[model samples]
Target: MIRTVVVAGALLLGIGVVAAQQDALKSAQAIMKANGKSLGGVLGPMNKGEKPYDQAAVNEALNTLDDTAKKLPTMFPESIKGMKAEGDYSPSSKIWEDKAGFTASIATFAKTVTDAKASVKDLNTLKAAFPAIGKSCGGCHETFRVKNS
Candidate 1:
């Protein structure tokens, strides 16, 4: 019957939408993971003197994060809009509510890293540069991310 075909088609469409959401979620997480590897894994240790600072490595990390900031917004589609952020760095539901603010936050991060790329010339400057980047990150997190719950 036509009704049966319509029902089946609707179900298939729903499933496809859900699959797309899952894929977007996975990609956003992977992008965050990569940024974390560069920021937390490498740069944090370098700042603490646990690892020797290399300017080339620092530049790479900054570049990577800047690139991420640009792409991160695309990961948050309308499909995922208003969805509660569950994980450590997942976006808050407010991301859709205040999309302009969310986007401004991303722009701030990109600007911070872009400025940092020029300022971080040596170990001492690297240390000096961290607080600004950290503030940029913390500001965004405070407004747009849900962590530890």
Candidate 2:
């Protein structure tokens, strides 16, 4: 029957939409994880004095952070807004509830990175500069990211 065909078509369309949203979520999460690992891997050891400070590495990590900040706003689409946070890198639903706050966090992160790039010249400066960068990341994560339970 024509009605049966239409029903099946509607169901297929719904499934396709869900699948697309899942793909988008996974892609966004991967980008975040890579950025986090890249930055954290470099700065974390340096900050702890476990690894010698390397300006080139710091610069590269900051560049990654800069690019990630620009991509942050677009990663949260409407389709993924209400999805349950399942694991690491999952965005909180509060992101939609507080769009301006979320945006402000990104701006803060970008500015901190710019400052770090300008100031981090030596080990002492790297140590001095890292707290703000870490704070920016932690603050945003606290407000916008859903930690795994």
Q: Pick the candidate with the highest TM-score.
A: 1
Cα lDDT tens digits, model 1, 69-132, are: 8896897887875454446656677778899998888888888888888888988988998878
TM values, all candidates: 0.88, 0.87
lDDT of 2 by residue, 1-149 (tens): 99999999999999999998888788788777767775688888888888888888888888888888888888889899767544655788888999999999989988998888898888888889888988998898888878666
True-structure RMSD for candidate 2: 1.9
- Regions of candidate 2 where Cα sits further than 4 Å from its true position: none
At residue 15, candidate 1 shows an lDDT of 94
Model 1 / residue 57 / CA error / Å:
2.0
Stretches > 4 Å off in candidate 1: 84-89
Candidate 1 lowest-lDDT run of ten = 81-90
lDDT, candidate 1, at 6: 100
Q: How does each model score on lDDT?
A: 0.82, 0.84
Q: Indicate the TM-score of model 1.
A: 0.88
lDDT of model 2, residue 119: 88
